[model samples]
Target: MTDSSVDYGAVFKALVAPLLVMTPDFVILAASDSYLKVMGRGQADLLGQDFFAVFPPNPNDPDAIEDYLRASLERVVATGERDFMAVQRYDLEATGRQGVFEDRYWSAINTPVLGPDGEVELIIHRVDEVTDLVQQLGRSGERGVTGARAELETMRTDVYVRARQLLDVNERLKQTTSALQEALDRQRRFVFDASHDLRNPITGLLTELEVALSEPDSDLHPVLRKSLRDAERLNDIVADLLELARLDTATPTTTEPVDLAHLVMDELERRTLTATVLTRLDKQVVVCASRIRLARLLGNLLANAERHTTTTIEIIVTTDPPNAVLEVIDDGPGIAPADRERVFERLFRLDDARRQDPGGSGLGLPIAREIAQAYGGHLYAADHSTGARFVLRLPFAA
Candidate 1:
């Protein structure tokens, strides 16, 4: 086709974006002046040659340009599709310049040019080169990485400052705990001293009352006996408080192999609750734990169950490959979901159940849980078929 025959040639040439027309077989039929200049090639040189033969591939691979052209042509012909993008780097052999890396992410529109019978005679290929925009993005990314490094340094400084603050807080906590422990110790010593001093007076009063009761005129014997009972109860409370303080301050000792199954069974037998004891002891379920602490853990659980339940409590001792499981179940009223967790807190008794039973100190379960954790174990309440179930899971012997 002659340039004169095209009515819109001058207008199309005035457009800023590069445009080109090519044969279905990729022969360069025509190109705008901008296309020729951008590509650094002359219209005369490009006119009859295949467009793919005009540029070399990226130096990283020699045949990439040929592959790109073949794929582009196949896509256009097979699907009547357009809008393809690719980044190509090439050496301009005609210019004799070292290869310029061009990121030409181009978008192409393929239109089928039709003859009178509506048969496609040629393809009109139009493209916009977005290399400059892509290069600007690369520069932006380099700046972003530098900014990110500066931000990371700031974060490190913040972390160090926060760490110093936490260390100061921890040291203060240690001091507070030490002072509190000393106060508790003094309180325990006062109770022990008072109890010891009252013992002699209490004994002397009882002896005199016994002597008076033997005489015929003693109506005060009953009053004296009642006073003695009150004194004994007070003494028991004081002793228990002193024991609790000692336990609170005691340091943990080295762990050793303890017969956990035997310890549990002995505690159950002591209560004699008419409950069936199922023991599945793994002959050598030897765990690293303090013996006294383990016994206390087992005893507290057993006693808690016995106190709440009137009839039967079942104790199951089992060992998995890596964990020892102690499950105690009672047919008493199951703990309400809300109170289940709270019941394990120190001095926290639920108003529903423990309030009715006047025997609990409310410290049993919490002590058990503390002991369990000290030996690398955990205690939790679980749902059972008809009762409250407590499970103690401990790490098995290595």
Candidate 2:
């Protein structure tokens, strides 16, 4: 399409927030209304301006432009491909009242728009502000780690200073430390579970409220849809927080004879997953486990695969006599060997696609593993050639 055929100015204004449309040479073509609203910039000021000059590279990160935003735009221009940054601390010039540059963190993706000849034309720079999350994690993490380390160091110094006098008390001290460590672990788990449990009811309340507000007969419709958006976001966060809490509690799950193959097929039929399935369990392979819990576990894994990859997901199920082995394999970017273990850690989130996703709780993997453990089964990530492969082994009943 010719440039004159379309009103690019009006089109970009309707696009999402924190967005910028720029030329290959770094000229700002159009900034969305939402972006202008958030960044406190006017269309007149930004139009025809050099993007790099408008929003300079964050001084905090010396390589923000050279290695990041500018470089990403350059790549899109050169190769006509999209580049995503999971999380980056890229500061932006504070406009309007602030009137100074502020420390900002973002999860951004740069995409290219190709011309009729398949050459890159315009670059779409989109970002989600995650400065709050980064700041939160940094503060809590510092306090916890520092406090724990300081306490341990104090204990060590005391032991060292009284090495000779404390010889008899060494055994007692070792016992005390071990007990304290156990109590600390339990306390941490309790705190996590309590917070999550408290959030569950609150989320339920918000969900009901949202539904009430969304009714056709509701009089609050004119209040604007944007006002209730924050409530919905809070509900999502609370739900995710609750998912991980279940793992810390020894809540009883009612077990029954569940046909793994049938249940898997049932779950598969409920949704549309773009994947080729080769079902080997032609016969019913029953498992003695909590049907609800297993369904949740399997559903989480399938949803995870969908979130991580767009390519084919391979599903394999078989019986090894005493145990039934099920594998969910995908052809997306696989997890690193070093990170496989940490991927299951509580509150652990990998990237923009996984953690930053509005629906993700960052508790799916951990909860799934916990459910498996409860059933006397093991769930773990295995070595894969192309993408991620999750294996679940449970005692077979059929």
Candidate with the greatest lDDT versus the true structure = 2
RMSD of 1: 24.7
Which residues of candidate 1, in runs, are more than 4 Å off?
1-247, 274-282
**Which tens-of-lDDT digit does each residue in 70-154 have in candidate 2?**
6567757876888765555567777663335677666678889899999988988888886665455434433565476556555
Q: Evaluate residue 50 in candidate 1 and report its C-alpha lDDT on the 0 to 100 scale.
A: 84
C-alpha TM-score for every candidate: 0.43, 0.46
Q: Write candidate 1's Cα lDDT for 17-136 as tens digits.
A: 777777778887888888777777778878888876666565664434445445556546544545343333332454545565443444445566656965556666666665555445
Among all windows of 10 consecutive residues in model 2, the one with the lowest summed lDDT is 159-168
